[model samples]
Structures are given as C-alpha cells and as structure tokens.
Target: MKSILFYLPTVGSHDQVLKGMSGVNRQNYRNMLWQLTEQARAADELGYWGLSFTEHHFHVEGFEVSNNPIMLGLYLAMQTKEIRVGQMANVLPFHNPLRLAEDLAMLDHMTRGRTFVGIARGFQKRWAEIMGQPFGVGGTLSDAGANDRRNRALFEEHWEILKKAWTTETFSHSGAQWTIPPKGLEFPYDAVRSFGRGLDENGVVQEVGIAPKPYQHPHPPVFQPFSFSEDTFRFCAREGVVPILMNTDDRIVSRLMDLYREEAAAAGHGELRRGERIGVMKDVLVARDADEAHHWAARGGGFVFENWFGPMGFTESLRRVGETGPIGADYRTLVERGLEWVGTPDDINRKIEKLVTQHDPEYLLQCQYSGLIPHDVQMRSLELWATEIAPNWL
Candidate 1:
C-alpha cells in the first residue's frame, strides 16, 4: 500500500473562515502557499510515494481554495525532491483541451518527469457552469438528466482531444464538441509550410501538433478521480487510467475491483496481481488519542465533509453502516463510516490494515490536508502517519 498525500487545499481553519470570513486576501494566500510548500517538503522526506491537490474555484468562504492545481503542482515540484506532484483532478468539461495539453507537456519538462495527471468530469455548479458555458455544457451532480448527458459527452470529447494532442505527432479532430484546425482556416506561413506538415500546398490548415512532446515517453501516468459509474470503470480499464475509488464499502470496492480486472483482461491487460492499477482515496485525521483525533476531525476533515463536500453530494461514502440521508452530523459519524480513519494512530492502523490486507491496492491516497486543521496538528498527524501507521503497511 503505497501512500499518497492529498491536499484538499482549504486556505484556513473554521475559526478563520466561518461564514462571511474568508481568506481570499493576498496575505492569507501567501501563508497558504508557504504552508503547502512545507507540507510538500515533509511528504517528500517521509518516504511517501506522491502528493496531490484538488482543483476548485469560487471558494470565497475559504473552503477548498484549490483554484489551479496544475500551477500548484509545478510550485510543489520545485519545493520537493522526490514525491510526485499532481492534481487529484482537473475538471475536463471546463477546460480547452488543447491548452491543457500544452500546459501539461510544458510541466513535464519543468518537473523533469515528476508530473502526473488526474482527470475528472466537472461537478461544481458555480465555476464549472460558467467556465463550460462557451463549450455548450455545465457541471453535473449525478442527476442523470440532460445536463449530465451533455457534460459526459463534452468531457469524453475533450479527453479524446487531450490524448490526440499529446501522443499523436500530428492529429486532426472533427468531434461533436471540437475540431482542430477549422476547415476554412488557412495558415500561409511559408517558412513553416516549406519545412513540414500542418498546411497543404494550397496553404490551408490540415492538422496540428503540440510542441515539446512530453518528458516521459508518450505521456505521464493518467488517473481519473472517484469513479462510481460503470462506464467510468470500463473506460478506466480500457484506457489503463487508474480511478481513485472513494467508495469505502469493501463490498462495492471488492466488486469494482473484480470488475476492473475483468475489464482489464478484456482490454488486453491480462491477469493482473490483486489490486494492481487500483487506488483508494480515504479521509484521515490521526492523533495520539481519541479525544485529540476527534478534536482534529471536527475542525478539519469534518468541517470539509459537512460544509463543503456534503452540499456537493460527496459525503455519501462517509455515511454510517445501515444508515442513510445526510451524514457527518458530527465527528463521531465520520469516524464510524468505512470511508475514513479518524481516531488515534493505532485506531487508524486497525482500520487501514483491514482494508489493505483484504484488497491489497497499489495506491492508498489519503486526504491529509483537508479544511482548516491547524498546522501543528497536521504536522503531528503527518509524523504519526510516517512513524506509526505507514511502516506497518509499507
């Protein structure tokens, strides 16, 4: 079980960001950058496999202020030595896939192969809807309505364009949502056209190629964020993209794991080892004792689930066994769920061991930097994870 540190990237704690008080100011953002750098440095030295951040925006209330994870990833790469720097997800429907391809290729050069990619379909309404309006789609929340259908169509289309821009030397696309080198457009650069492809003898645009390629062969490792949909599962298996499973129910995860392997075999990835190419993302708030862990959870991880993800309909995995409806009524509820390990270091280890021993996943991604946990508390938990919990698994 290789561990990856995940930063929800909330700028401040509940005390500093409750209600109308938000930390969108330059000074608060500066402090956030500093703290995040320190966290990245710690993870690098702690023998952790990788570190990641979420991609979010419009958090004026200072909850999950991860506006641009790729930019954050580049900065983290400069600060850390070994740990891989990447986003847990960059929403696909909200981006121009061509520009995204160029930025990532440039990042691969800058990071010297320390870069990875995590993709997701947009889920936030505020930014996702506005950003996607030009592209004829909007954010979705699993409602499975027309909005979801449109979002999925555009997301898949953008994904195809991204791959074409990266792997193909010169590619042309005529998809439902996009077309590279618009048919009527003409580029009559004589020096360029005289040299190679992209323009025809009539000086009409034919195809396009992204520059610099990538530091890693074809491209960096690609992963998709929390996948519950069967189509996403099959897509990941087919494309060899690892889907970080947020479904903590082993019954569901176990079945998905089997289904993933079955799909992989059909996709020509034959006979994988148990849990190969699989990842699980779990919430965690560890401390020396139950009381301290409970304290940490309320102000930090619990605040995130209740205030942020809860409204976004993402706290489903944190529900108690045999219970339904709204969750994270209190810290104890988060602790009771299969999705998180919020307790003493020993307690977390007990729960973690149960999962890994049964599933044996290749990657164990934890939400280490959620909400407004105090820096000291986060550091102590980091130490506990490095010294007490991780060694048992690694």
Candidate 2:
C-alpha cells in the first residue's frame, strides 16, 4: 500500500505565501480557514490517506498560523470522515505533555479514531526565550552535542512517564519537571482500560487503566518527524514509532530505509513492510502548466525562506534540538533546490516516479505548507496532484 499525505499551508497569515500576492488582507484570513476546510474535504473524497499540519510559535515565520494546531485538527476531524488527521508534528518539548496527551485523546474520539500524533523536541531559541527557557548560546558550552543530549534526555524521560500515564494503572511518577500524585487520577470515560485482569465494582480497574481509552487499541499511532538519524531510526524500530523524514536528500532516504530494513532483520523483527512507518517528504507545487507552477512557487518559496527559514534559523535550531549538525547551505539555495519539482502534471509525475522507484518509501509527504503560498494556489496544487498526478501512481 502506498501512503499519501497532504499538508495545509500557512497562507492565512501574510508572512509567507501572501508576500507578493495582492488582495490578501484581513478578510482573506477568515476566507483561508474555509478554503482549507474545503480542500480537506476534497482530500477525503479523493482517496488521500492522511492530512497533516505543521506547528510553530509566533508570527515571524510565515509557515505558522496564530491559531493552535490542535484546534485545526479538531476542525478537520469534523469536516472529514476517513482521512487520518495529523500534526506533521506538534512540538512536544514546548508543550505540557499531559495537556498534549489529553487534547490528542479528545481528538481521536472526535475523529472517530482517525488521529495520528507527530512529535519533535523543539529547536527555536527565540521561542524558548519567550517561554523563559535558556537559549543555547552560539559558540558556547551549549553546543550541538550538549543541547542534543539535554533534549534527548528530556524526551526519554517524558515518554517514559507519558506511556505509563496512557497505558498503566494507578502509576506514580516523579521527574525533574513533573510529579504525579499518588492514588492516580481517574481515567477519562472515553479512555481505554488496558488490563490483563478484570474490572471491579466502582467501574474501577487494576493492572492498567488509562483515562479516556483511545478508540484505537494500543493507542493511536505515534510518529517521529525528522531526517537521517541512526539512533532515532534504531529507537523507532525498537519501539514501533513511525519516523517521518522531511527535507531529506534522496540518497540519504534510500540509505536510511535500507538501514531500517537491515536493523529490523538483525533484531529478529519480522519482514519490514512499506507504509508501516517510514515515510519521506517532498516540497511540491502543481499547476495547469509548468510556467504557472514555477511563477507561483518562486514567489511563495522565497517568502518562506525569508520569514521561516532565514529568520527562524531551522538549521541552528535542529542542530541544538539534537538533529544532525549544520544544514550546509543558505535558505535561498535550499528553497531553490526544493523547488526542483514545481511543474506541470507530466513533469511532476516523472520526477515522483523516479523518487518512488529509487527510494520506495512507505509514504510521501507533499509540501503544501512550509512557505507562504496563497490558499487558491495551494488548493489548485492539491487538486492537480489529486486529479492529475496521484492517479498515475494509483
């Protein structure tokens, strides 16, 4: 099975997509919401399997909206019936995990069990400063190694506690940043009760009882979004976490998938299957013709570089958050490189065919977000891909 995912861009705000487009004023902001909702509805109809949105803080980057992603997920859930609603990731480190967990649980129920969660240790210094956390000073003691270690440790500790909260009964946890009360809290009514034993009179259960049991058993799937990390790959395979690779080089994606397959076999895990967890992402724009595609992407992609890539310093933040060091190029260069695919249906199909043949990833994430592309243009791209491009593969 080939997994296909769709992203809703951040065009509501004038930061990225609306940079050069005329008529994108305040009223259009409200219009963008309705526009996205309809696009999502179309996705559900067109056989798209997953819908994802990116998360960010502040308005500096054009890729993010002032509205919370969880709220957007809920809205998408109401509009569509089958498509899996996802946050290509919601930043885990920036949020209170418990609140994040609760909101996700509610979203799962709201969507009739079509919720997927993506997590990342955040990498923005300015955002961290806004939150009053220490920003990693450049060329100081807090280099990439130190920062990665801190973030990795925090993620491990948080996961250990969170899984317990979600999958166990009456557990108590004590950590540097969090302390759970004894006697345990009541599970939400919707929470699944996971236990080897039976239930008691007071509707209370033992062994393991999670509040608001998720509609899906063993919890709705957990996804980790990043690129090219050996440790992350090993950990994901061991723990059954899906890894979402983004802005990744083609050769690296092939190598990583091979590595994952080898490790899974070496560890006595069953034959690794595609669409099971490993997925690669691509930046895309499709249009009626190659000229139109190039024109729009060049304009929109530049804004993304200026607002999000240039200012937010993705390269620096990812390095600090334990991603592999320095991105190795300028924002404009990277954006131009990614725009290698902005073309008409035939050109896109051929390029994607090569990627599919070469990498054979479980899934492909189309970049509809990440820059400031207008809602109409974004929707047109989605339509063209779904109607013209995707069907070839299907």
Candidate 3:
C-alpha cells in the first residue's frame, strides 16, 4: 500500500494550544515551517508516497494553522524531493475558481508532476461561512442539508473549472456561481489581433486560458479528503477522484467500498477490483511501548479530539459500535473504537496487518500529530512506521 503522511499542521505544543497561544505568534509560524520542511525532507528520503496538510484558517487557538495549502505546498515542494506535497484539501467554496485554478496549475508545473489536489465541502463555520459568502454557501457537516447542497454545487463547479483550466486549450464557463471572462466586459480581443484565440463570431469574450498549463498532461491527480456518503462515493467514482475512507468501522467502511465498486462499474469504469484506487486514513502513533504511545497520544492526537473534535462534532467517525452519547468523548473511546492506534511498533504492525487484510486499500494515510507531538517523537514514529510496518504492505 502507498502511504501519505496526513499532518495535522498544528503550530505549537498541547499546553500552548490549550492556552490558546502560539498559532498567531510570528516566531512560532516561522519555526513551524522549518520544522515541517524537515519532516517533509525525511519522509521523502524514507520512501513515502506523499505528505499532505489541511487548509485551515483563523487558528489563533494554535491548532490547524495551515492557511493556504497551495502556498505552503509550494514551499514544501521546493524543500523536498520524491514525496509529493499538497493539501489534504483546500476548501473549494472558499476560493475563486480562476485564481485557484491558476495557482494549482502553477504548483503542478513547479512540482514537475509531483503534486496532488484534494477537495473538500468544508465543515468549519468559523472561516468557511465567511469565506464562502461570495458563492452563497454556508458551512455544513451533514450530507443532505441545504448548506451541504450549496457547498457541493460550488464544489463541483469549481472542480469542473479547475479541470477545464488544465485540460482544455481555451474554455469559457457560464455557471450558476461564476461566469468566465465575466459578462459585458471589454477585452483586448480586438486590440492586438495577435492574441491567438479570444473572441467568437459574436465577439463575446469567448474564452480565457490559464497560463503555464499543468506539467502533467490531463492534470495533477485529485483526491477527496474524506468520504462517508452515497452521493460522495458515486461522485468520486464518476469523476475518478479517490475518496479517503474516514471511518474505521468494519460495517461502515466495507459497505462504502462495495458501493464505490458498484458505482464505478455502473459509471463505465469497468469491473474495478476490490481496493482499487481507494484510500483509508487513520490516526496512528507508534512508540517504544504501549505506555509511551498512549502518553504521547493523550498529549497530542487525543488531546485535539477531546478538546476540539469532540465539541465540534467531528468525531462521529470514531463512534463505538452500537453505542452512543458524546461521540469520542474521551481518549479511551478513541482507542477502543480503533479510530486512532497508539501502541508499540509490534502492536502497530499487527493492527496494520489486520487493517490491510480486511480493507485492502491502495493508499493508507497514517496520521501522526504535529506541533503538539514533539518533533522527536513524531520522527521516531515515522521511522518506526516506515521501517517496521510499511514494508509489510509494500
């Protein structure tokens, strides 16, 4: 299985984050970038498939501080060699499709076909709502809410435009959310006559093209950060976008995989094999022993889930089988649910082996906390995972 390091990108320690400090501190930001670069460099040398960070904003709370993943990815891309760098996603509704299209195309060119893109519907109301105002979208977490529909509308439209920008020579878009070249706007279409293609018979500013088209022919590969819905699965199946499974529940994940395969075949992707073009993400922490693993997990991944994901209602994926009330309410539930693995290297290997045998996923995103988990501990986990566990799958 190919592996991607899904970094949380927090900007400080668990103590600093709990105190609502360090995220906005200039020095911390600087140090975070350098330290992240080192991590990327190491992952590259260690034979990782890719490394991704989330696109978050307004994190004065010292958690989820990755602001613009394209920029952050560009910086990291310049610093590392083999391992691809990109966002687990940039929230689609928050961006202008043209600008995002151009930025990503440039990134693909710079990375020399080493970049990948992830798209999200966005669930954070704090920044997502404010940023999505232009597109008439609101933040949502459910699959069928009004906000969810709006976000998906814009999400699909933006991706359509991005692909067009990369694959089509010159394209014009007239969509519900945006119109290319805008309406009633005059251009230099007639001024220079040297411009290769710009106007139609009616001279209506026919189309606009993004410069520095992607280095990869069709485009850089695309991914969906998380998936749990039928609509999302079908959409990914049709669009050829790989959806990373978010939940570890056997019933849930297995059912979703079956749905994806059926939909892919129905969508003319042919009889896709089990575990083809799919991914699974899990929170993992490997240490010298079970005690050491739990110690760091409690201070890092578990801390974030308890203090942040729990109240934010982002922990449903970790809900225990046939159990309810306060999902992922504590660290113990997190471990019990198998949502995050914290154990010795041998224990981790066993769990990973079981996971692979059960799921057979092509991509495995091993999530290791950053910022809150000390750099040394994170590196050790990476080393152990790459050395002991990764080879089994490879």
Worst 10 residues of 1 by lDDT: 320-329
Query: What lDDT would each prediction earn against the true structure?
Result: 0.81, 0.63, 0.83
Which digits, one per residue and each the tens of the lDDT, describe model 3 over residues 1-394? 8999888877877777767667888877776777788888888888999988888778788887888888888888898888897788888888888888888888988999899989888888898877778778878787677888888888889989988888888888888878887876555456524555767655667677889788888888888977877788889999998999888688888888899999999889998778788999888888887898898988887888888777877677775468677664588888888877778888988887888788788888777678888888888888888898788779
lDDT of 1: 0.81
All candidates: TM-score:
0.95, 0.78, 0.95
| TM-score ranking from best candidate downward | 3, 1, 2
Candidate with best lDDT = 3
Evaluated at residue 182, the lDDT of candidate 1 is 88
- C-alpha displacement of 43 in model 3, angstroms? 0.7
What stretches of model 1 exceed 4 Å from their correct place? 318-329
- Which of the two candidates, 2 or 3, achieves a greater TM-score against the reference? 3
Model 2, residue 357: what's the lDDT?
A: 75
- Which regions of candidate 3 fall more than 4 Å away from where they truly are? 188-195, 201-203, 320-325
Descending-lDDT candidate ranking: 3, 1, 2
Q: Across residues 144-217, which tens digit of lDDT does each residue of candidate 1 receive? A: 89999888888888889988988988989998878788897787898767676788888888998999788888
Per-candidate clashes come to 1, 14, 0
Better of 2 and 3 by lDDT: 3
